[model samples]
Target: MTSGTADSGRVRSGLRGAAWLLPAAIVLVALNFRGPIVAPAPVIGDIRADLGMTATVAGLLTTIPVLCFALATPFASWVIARFTAERAVSLSLVIVLVGTVVRSIPHEAALLIGTAVIGIGITIGNVVIPVVIRRDTSPERVGLVTGVYTSALNIGSMTTSLGTAPIAAAWGWPIAIAVWGVLALIAAAAWTYTVGAGAAWRGSDHDSEPLPVTGPIDQVLDTGSVRTATEQRAAVIETLPHPAKRWVTWGLMLAFGGQAFSYYALTAWIPTLLHDEIGFDTASSGASSSVFQILAVVGALGVPVLANRFRPRVIIVLVAFFWLAMPLGLLIAPQLWLLWSVLGGAAQGGGITIIFIVIVRLVSNDDDARRMSAFVQGGGYLLGSAGPLVAGALHGATGGWTAPLLTVLVAVLLLGVVGSVSARKVR
Candidate 1:
């Protein structure tokens, strides 16, 4: 056969191979995003004693990462634009690996600095994964893959939260927190292998541009026309409204902020709330909180199934109801903590999934996807990073769970209102 025919065969082979491997790689990477942040929480007292830090400083271990999620988003967007999504993922994993090792070094300064580095690394992953999902997955499968991706995030959080304190007991908190880096290293190697294999088959070195199905060979073979087409597309995008100016974008940002605020606040203090309000012991309270984290997987997976049958607005309303029920249920009937936790868990998980789905559906292309994801997540996390602190402060001031639960209820109300407005059909 001719050279053109041979090249086509190689491209097709690469596509088929990537179809399965890509999603697996995405899931693996997802598993690392939240695990590292939550790992230190279960062993915070040990960590504080070991490092000689006060409670406020120790709290930064988790807070720093959420702040980084907001602060580093613009930088994350730039990295994706500079390097391809595949290379960005590899770089993020490497950064996470290095940060994990640094945090395990048994020094207070190292622990704090290392936590910041991990946050920065995870920020990059947060921005890119959605872009990769939007670019690689077929239109029909985007919702399914997004759900799986979000669900994996919860699984990681649940795994680390439930497992860390025991591991710390056996081997020390440093080792307990550091062990998660192994997963990041494995994911990096797997992702790097896929990128290399695809590059070899496609026979290209430039990773700056998104290629059509046939790959970068087309650009190499027809540089002038490809450049013109790219320029034209950019010009068209320029003519449209900026992402910042769009009402839907702002609505989604608020929706995400409310979701993040509720999730982080609850994750940080649900055990304490249960102990104080429901009279559960320390161990029981901790175990009960796990119910909230683990049930998120169900919520994440359920959103896609609901999407198949209902309009986006209907799903948003339903999720909002669940979110509203959690705070109200906790305030009115603390006896049913289990039931409220399950509903709240599902609401948080489904809330994030639906926002992601709306983002991917609303954007016109990969560049738009990157920018929009960064904008929404950056704003959302900035608001979210305040959740735990605010909840703690309210509890301290009022000396009751009632005030904090009311605060959470207000945030959920914002979520329902803005989420409904955001989900309205775009004309």
Candidate 2:
């Protein structure tokens, strides 16, 4: 054999090894996605008192990151596609690390800015995760990994939510936020090791031919500077076919987006709604909020078992019915409805899992999968940005949640519509 062919074979071998390391990186980053945002929720009061933030301002502080997801996603996608996924992951860790340090400061401005930075990092990682799992793992294992990965995201969020307050009490909020920097550093190290191993394997190969997945890596390198891979991923998605034309794509979008509307909206405004509308005390309202979050973690963890046995579409249909009932049931009966709220959050928690699964199954190829994933999340989150804010505004204008509740009620119905279609046996 020619030396060129031998070198090429060796590089391919190395690349395969690097690909295998992807899941661990994905799991770690998935768990870390909501850490920056959720960790501070439990300690907001202290931050408020210490930083002199008003309620409206604190609301902005939270919303700033959500808005970044909407705005930064396109750029983030472009980034992931341009630099090679592993390099993109590495870059995002730096973003997270920088953001964490910034938030560690006592100033409100710095904290909010840092939150936006972290959101940008997480946004890229979030959009790409399913694509990574779907393309990298064997198809038979997808359901299980999807479940664990989604669960990790919720657990990560829950971990921060539950642990952040105590952490703040011990080290102060600055240190609390800063501590996450260590997590980012660890993720970055693992990813670097994995990618380097892949490159080493390839570099040592005797052949000079490019790898199969070189398209995405070259696209990333071609589209953007080495620094902005997430931006590159976003750019690549805009140029692709509408994956929604496929049943799985649309179904996942509807189910997932509808679920996100409820999840993000309630998480944003639930405490206020309970406190203001239900006359619950501040502590009681916050506790109620935590219940929703904690239960979501449970739902996320539980989806894989169901998906493994039944057809994914069938499972989606059942999930859809349950989802439709949750919010509508709450609207119908508001008496001691904290349990209902928790139930709704728990059901909606599956939305993230469904989103991951659908993207993996919908597209026929890796490029399509990543593009579809970006489009769905990009569109879904843009819509999600409106959910809580619009609900708040509608309630403000109407003087009751009548309009807002009805809207979510309709959204619940539509979620089933989209999910049922997507869940249909993928063509």
**lDDT: which candidate is best?**
1
Q: Put down candidate 2 lDDT per residue, 1-427, tens digits, no spaces.
A: 6654454334434435565576676667766676676656666677889999865566555566666776787898798767666666677778888888898889988988888888788778877666667655666777667777776676676666556666777878777767867777777777777667766765675345533323344453452334353454455555555675555555565566676666666666665666666776544555566666667656676776776666766656666666665556656776556667566666776767765776676565556776677777776666666666667677678877667777776776666667767666742
Residue 71 of model 2, lDDT score: 78
For each candidate, the alpha-carbon lDDT, in order, equals 0.81, 0.67
Error of model 2, residue 332, in angstroms = 5.8
lDDT tens readout by residue for model 1, 3-25: 54554433432423357777777
TM-score of each: 0.88, 0.77
| Model 2: lDDT of residue 21 | 73
RMSD of 2: 6.4
TM-score of 1: 0.88
Candidate 2 residue-wise lDDT at 36: 73
Clashing residue pairs in candidate 1, if any? none
